[model samples]
Target: MQCVNYLFLVLILTPILSTFSAKILGLFLYPSRQHALLGTALFAELSAKGHEVTMISTFEQPMVQKKFRHVLVDGTQIRQKYSPSLMSLNVSMWEHIVFSNSEMKYMIAELLEDSSLREFLDAGEKYDVVVSELFAEALLGISHRVNATTVSFNPTGGSYELDYLSGNSHPYSYVPNAFTAYSDEMTFWQRFANTYVNLFCAFSKHFFNLPMQRSLLKYYFPDAPPLEDLMNSVELHLVNSYYLFETPRPYLPNVVQIGGFHLQKPELLTVELLKQLDELKNGIILFTVGSHRKLSDFPVQIVETLFASFSKSSHNVLVQYEGPPPSNLPANVRLMPWLPQRAVLSHPNTKLFITPGGRSSVVEAIYFAVPMVGLHAPGDDDSQLSMMANRGFGVCFRLDEELREEQLSGAIRNVVADPVYKRAIMLESELFKRQEMSPLDKAVYWVEHVAKHKGAKRVKSQPAAAMPLYKYVLLDVVVASAALLVMFAFISLWLCKQTYRVLIRRRQTEPVKHKIV
Candidate 1:
């Protein structure tokens, strides 16, 4: 009822508010397909708000091209979307790059030095504001050049935010996980490691020309904060999460977490789809290795094991196999090149989701509150999947390990039989609902607010970004020490002069004749 009332008020006032005409030139630098959709949705939403918008993407997605005509650059130069192979790196190398705080700064600086892209950016005209994807730091200089309000749009769930906001500590600060308010969770060594990372970033910044940092400040309007809180530079933070999936963080007037607002509802299944779903008597378990892994890449032995196990069972399985759907399908098993994930997840009959713990997949499952079974694979494996299992939402098993088919099957049976996991998810779903306003309304209001205000400076305040770690802690003790030492030397010299004067006076009185003559 309250929601209805709010909607009614918004509808009534919307026309009055429509007088403000704004234009947003969307700039995204990444080659990922997902970023393309985000760019599209943002362009579309802004357009719906009566804002003139144009989208530029490195690659085109079907969803984005439906509405916004995009200019495509060479994608071969861009990293492949969802490439897991590049995810591998030693801790030392990762640490060095991250700690120096220079990695993002340097990369963005080098990237923006492009003459042709600069031409596009230079062509960007009298827009009310520029909302660049976080990766589009490449456009910071351009944004500054255009005198546009620069806002950063981060799609990942607030994992990238610590670089810009203040008061949050290190390590646990950068790693995005379920939120726990401060306690002894981070150890001494971890804090030191994180500190070095920020320092390195600041140190590295000196080597780059000042244009990147200057452009960052010109548009982002953070509290003139330190390098650690770089992401805070955006006037508005469009966090890609809803209240249900996250714990309550006291959001500022500037930050909004709007997830699933643009997500289309699960489409109704075709009769064949319904018929196929109904066939899962024991239960249906949906599995995909996520986007990058070719299903053919899995060991044939493991594939054979899965088939053999499901073939014997009465339970039905819909496995997203990339290669031609396997022949000789059993009565209880089906192979699909793909299935509408949300539709299957929404099915009342669907029992459990067995997947590699990709962030998107996890969020989707959480939105439905389904328990997961993570078949964690090697390499770019289930580092995140393991975290989810540890969170008590799911169980994980190595796909290439000694865990036999029966062992995997038994775990599935347990998750299905136990009512607790499902109940916990339902509770989380309810929290999601309570934690946020309608994602659409929240997002629309913020975008307009940026335009109406004409810049983020009106709302962007979290001043912690302005100071380095040492300065924030007031560790300028060396300055104080130097002052004290100077004062002490002056006092000693004065005393020595006085003592010499007294001794000379006494000597003159006692033995003036002999010595002076």
Candidate 2:
């Protein structure tokens, strides 16, 4: 009877003990608001599942759970230091790279000195898992210090750099760089350029960024393991990418594509906005440059061109402009400081979306089945928007194009007038909707699984991380084959020459040529 009672007691306590929450630390230092939102989705979900989450970021969270703590970092100086020029659209790739490195260094130094962060570090807080944005690899030090499994998160899609770290395959021939305006099927020159750019970026990261990352990690956590080892030691990489928008490519088992994880059911539009939208007899067009860019920063001429196009179009143009409203706005145009983009897109009257082709914006547009006219900027925007155009769901024009006004207006007219764009988008939307689980659900599960299992050792591709470059690319085999072929050719030539010499010597020595003559 005593043994039966003990067993009953053990069974009753097991579930209660297992229900205890795990502690998670999230360090999301990306300065962009949209990127912050992505990080927010992650932490908020973890907290909802009864995990204790401590997040340090530039953005604040309204999450009121007692288990959720937000350590808002002051990114004002960092933001100002790398602030993109509003008046210019001609920033070079090298300049962007330099600025990005500078930003990472500054953030790392600041975070190290931050009193709150230092307090946690000094106190030796224990966490089951540490989450950080994949950029600024030095931030992985947080996980190292806490002795927690690291999980890298990327609000943007995958890239060769990230692929290399995660041991994912990204052949430049078929897998275009996220920054280039090329499709998977490339011309010879395009492939060459892609390969060159990938190599350049790889070298730049290795020579320029890796040293700084190592220095920072050493400065903060002198006893920690090597930074490069810690970077790959990252158990999982959660990327914001989908095979629908991106070319279908094999990813490392540890790399999870949780694209559209930020998506939620569209909120009901305000009555006033609904009524206003209903008044658009020809339908509405939503224009947003995404969260990071200020629509007001557009050059006067560019704004004039957009306005000019809007003036001629029958569609009601609703612009999400951060700055003061433009003067002499056309009656058909309306400007708001902010618009509920997802809600606006879900509206039946939202006939089009004009954006700078940021991944988040493009995903929302496709999710809502709205045709788009892309005013793409440099960087990944160009490639993503270009891919959309290639896939027949939208049209893309570079923001710096001399004839942008004409192109923008033409694209708008064409997309709206034709049924093909709509049909294509509807098909993609249906396909996107066919997923068995939401992206957030998948992300949450993987994150929790990594923590529960102590790491994702089983899912990680072993050969990818362990294989050296020469072996992985088969360079050794190619070089050996080439050397063999050269040796054989040389031997054959030498043998032929020797045979000729022998024939000549025999004829001269024996005097046999007289008979032949």
Candidate 3:
């Protein structure tokens, strides 16, 4: 009877005791909604798994869940200061780097001074893990204060900076820079350009971006660890990238690719929307420039060009615009303030997606098997658009004041009329959907793995992470090999010369032996 009772008690408590949860803090300080979506989805999943999650962002609360707490930071001034317009597309890469660094410095300073964030920091809350976007360096101070393992998250494909943080090797020869339009295969000039951009970005980040962040962090959180220490202490990187979208690249043990994890199943379309799309028998072209830019902000000439091009399209056009409908709006075109992008793409009528090549939009298009006619603005997802075009499922056009209606219309017509684009994307969609484990499950597992292992120290690449750039790239070894080769060549040449000299001396000293021969 005693044994029976003990077994019953053990059985009753086992299930309850095995259920584990961690206190997770997520910091996504960027003001863009597309960037916020990635972090919000990850935290929402963690919260669903019974973890107590506190999310801080500049955007509004995403979801209302029992275990999920949201802290909103007012970023109105920051957005106004750094708002990108269509004209920004014309800015040179060097100008962009300088401008973006300035924006990051301003944003960090503003975040450190926010009253609500300060209150949250002073609350003495403890957390098991801290998940932050790639740019949120100052906010890592919260992780230091709470003594949590840090996980850096990138909303797009991993960059050189992220690779450095996770100790992942990104060879500049083949692996194109995130901002460049080149694919894995490159010409001599293309490779040179890619390498130059990668080095420039690395230099700027190390010298300008990081030092300014450190100064602000020090002023705000004097007791916090050094910025370099905090950055290096990060245990894992969760990047929104995959093999299909971002060509095959090497990832370290601590780096996790969780692309498309935020994608939810397409919901049923609204009755009115379904009706609107259903009436279009030919096909539908869904057009949107993404959340970061507004059609209203576009220059009059560019907007007129877009309208004129859409007017010539045979397919019904669905434009996602915020301003009043144009007086000359074509009969084939309809404008909406927002779009149910996934749902619309899932519809059978949505034949071609016209987008500005935003990362999230590109992923969604691939997920839904919709062919794209990308009007890519500079500094946008030009690389992704290039990839899509290389795969033969999309057409890319430069979106600028110089864009002509005939050029836009012809590409749109060709993509919509051709079946090759559809076939190519359908194959890609099949591969993208064939993952063994869902991205969300994979992301959650890694986050928990880090928490359970107390910072996941075992998986970290200690040597690579601590290595200086010279040693990391093996510059010293190359120099040594070149020096040795030169020494060997010199020695061989000297020996040949000496042998000739000796033979001549022997012949001269041999008297009349040569005459006999």
RMSD of each: 8.5, 3.7, 3.6
- From the highest TM-score down, the ranking of the candidates is 3, 2, 1
Report the lDDT tens digits of candidate 1 across residue range 308-358.
666754457788876765565567667787677777887877788888666
Better of 1 and 2 by TM-score: 2
The lDDT values for all models are 0.60, 0.81, 0.84
Per-residue lDDT of model 3, residues 1-517, tens digit only: 9999999999999987898889999998887877876778889889988899999988887575799999988887767667663126666657767865676677677877788888898899999999988675777888888889998898887677788777789988888887787888889999999999999999988888878878877988789988878878898988888888886778888888888888753446899999988888899999998877788778788999998999998888999999777778889988999887878988888999998887788988999999998887765648788889899999888888879999999988999889999999999999998998999899999999887777878878877777778899899999999999999999999999999999999999986845664
Candidate 3: list runs displaced more than 4 Å: 1-12, 85-87, 264-275, 278-282, 478-517
Candidate 1 — which residues are off by over 4 angstroms?
1-18, 62-68, 73-84, 87-126, 145-147, 160-162, 165-233, 242-253, 264-275, 278-282, 297-314, 324-333, 375-387, 398-407, 468-470, 477-517
Q: Ranking under lDDT, best-scoring first?
A: 3, 2, 1
Give the TM-score comparing model 1 with the true structure, all chains together: 0.69
Q: How accurate is candidate 1 locally (lDDT)?
A: 0.60
| Candidate number with the higher lDDT (2 or 3) | 3
- Expressed as tens digits, the lDDT of each residue in 274-297 for candidate 2 is 889887878999998887667787
Q: lDDT (0-100) at residue 406 of candidate 3? A: 95
Clashes of each: 16, 0, 0
Q: How many backbone clashes does candidate 3 have?
A: 0
Q: Relative to the unseen true structure, what is the C-alpha lDDT of residue 46 in candidate 1, on a scale of 0 to 100?
A: 68
